[model samples]
Target: MQDDLVRRAVEDGDQDAIRAFLADICSLTDMGFAAVARVTEDRWIACQVLDKIEFGLTPGGELAVATTICNEIREHGHAVVFDDASAEPDWRTHPIPILYGFKSYASFPIFLSNGDFYGTLCAIDPARRRIATPQVIATLRAYAAQIATLLEVRSPPTA
Candidate 1:
C-alpha cells in the first residue's frame, strides 16, 4: 500500500542514522518527543519516533491530518516554533498546543532534493523550553536537511 511505501522510504535508509537524528534532536532540544512524520494532503504518518515521555506513537502510527500543526507546515512550507505556547497570544487560541499539553514545540519542513515536500522533523515537550534560539533552530534545520537527503537517496527517481 502507499502507507507502507512511505514507511519503507524512511526505514529502508540508514535507519540507525534516522534514529540518531531523532535522539539527538530530542536531547539537544531537551524535549520528550521527537519524530519524522510523513505529512501528505490527507494523512500524517509517523515514519520514526523517539518518545521519552510516552506520547504513545510509534513508526507507522497515524495522527489525524487536520489536527496537527505539521499539516499547516505542509501548506505554508515554514517552520513552527515556540518556547511557551501558553505565553504566545497566537498559540493561546491555537488548539494543538492546548490539546496536546505541550508548551514547547517545533516542526521544520523537510524538502527532498527534488523539491518535493516530504514531511517534518519535529519535537514537543510538556514543559517550557528554550528551543526558539537561533542556534537551536539552525541545528534543527540542519537535521531536517539531512533527513531529506537520506530519504532522497533511497527514493526512486522521478519520471
Candidate 2:
C-alpha cells in the first residue's frame, strides 16, 4: 500500500512524490511547507524540500538548521509545528529560520527500526501557519517513517 509507493519513490529518488504525499496529506488537514532532512552523527542534511524552502552556508560556513534540529531531535525526538518564532521560546534566538525566510515550522525525528536516528522530516512556511489538528501531525509522522526507511536502505553497510 503506502509502503510500496514510498519504496518506489525512494528507488526513483522521486522527491516530488514525497513532497506531494506530504502536501496532499497536509492539505486535508491544512498544513503547509512539508520537507525532509537527513541527519548524520555530527550534522543534519537538508535532502528534500516540499515547499517554500531555502538553505545555504551560514556566515560561519556550516550547515544551517542541521545543528539546531539535530540537538532538538536528540533531546525531544520531535518538534511540533509552531505558528511563529515568538511562540518558540528557545528558537526565538536561533538564526537558522530567520536568516532563511522560514517563519513557522514542524519536524519529526527520523529513526531506524534499530533505534538509530538519521535526521528529520519537517514542514516550514514563510508566514505563521496554524496546525491544530492531530491528523496533520499523524501525517507528518507517517512521512517521517518513510524517510527513516529510505535512510536505512540507502546508508552504507557497517562493518
Candidate 3:
C-alpha cells in the first residue's frame, strides 16, 4: 500500500507525462533503461520505467534494495554517475554493475518539498556510454526537480 502511494505520487496521475519524461531522459543520456524507483529502507519499487534494451523491469516491479546503488544515493543524497563502470577504478569491481551487466550508470536523488527523500531517477546501459558530462548531469538534476514538484503538488495533504 505504501509503495503504491509512492508510485502514484511519482506518476502524479499522469502516465503519459511520466512515460514521455522517462523517454526523454533515456534519449538524453543515451541509456537503454531509465527508471524512477521508490526506495525505502527495505525495498526498491519501480514507479516508472523506459526500457529500450528489454532489461525486463516494469512499473511496480521490485528489486532488492540491498542490490541497488540507489540505496547509497538514498543514504547520502548524492548523484552517482560513471561513464564506464568497468573502466572506473572505484566501480570496476563493484558488484552492482557486474550483477546487472550494465556498463554505464547514473542516478540522481529525488526529494520532496518537505525535504524528505523520495527515491531516485536512474539510468543504465549495457554498453559503455558517455553519460557523465556536465550537460547530462544538469539535465538529470532538472528532471529530478521537476518530478519532485509534480509529486509535491499531487500529494495528499497531511492530517
Scored by TM-score, the top model is 1
| Regions of model 1 farther than 4 Å from truth | 1-14, 157-159
Candidate 3 Cα misplacement greater than 4 A, ranges: 1-14, 156-159
> What's the CA RMSD of model 1 in angstroms?
1.8
Error of 3 at 77 (Å): 0.6
| Clashing residue pairs for model 2 | 39-118
Query: Scored by Cα lDDT, where does model 1 land?
Result: 0.87
TM-score of candidate 3 on Cα atoms, chains taken together: 0.91
- Candidate 3's residue-wise lDDT over 17-63, tens digit each? 66777999888878999988878888888878899999998877788
lDDT (10s digit) by residue, model 2, range 1-159: 334423432343344555566676457544445555555555444455544343442111224444465556756776556667756886677776676566677778877788776566666667777654586678777877876666556553243
lDDT for each candidate structure:
0.87, 0.58, 0.85
The full ranking of all candidates by TM-score, starting with the best, is 1, 3, 2
Residue 114 local lDDT, model 1: 68
TM-score of each: 0.93, 0.66, 0.91
Q: Which ten residues in a row have the lowest lDDT in candidate 2?
A: 53-62
Best candidate per lDDT, number?
1
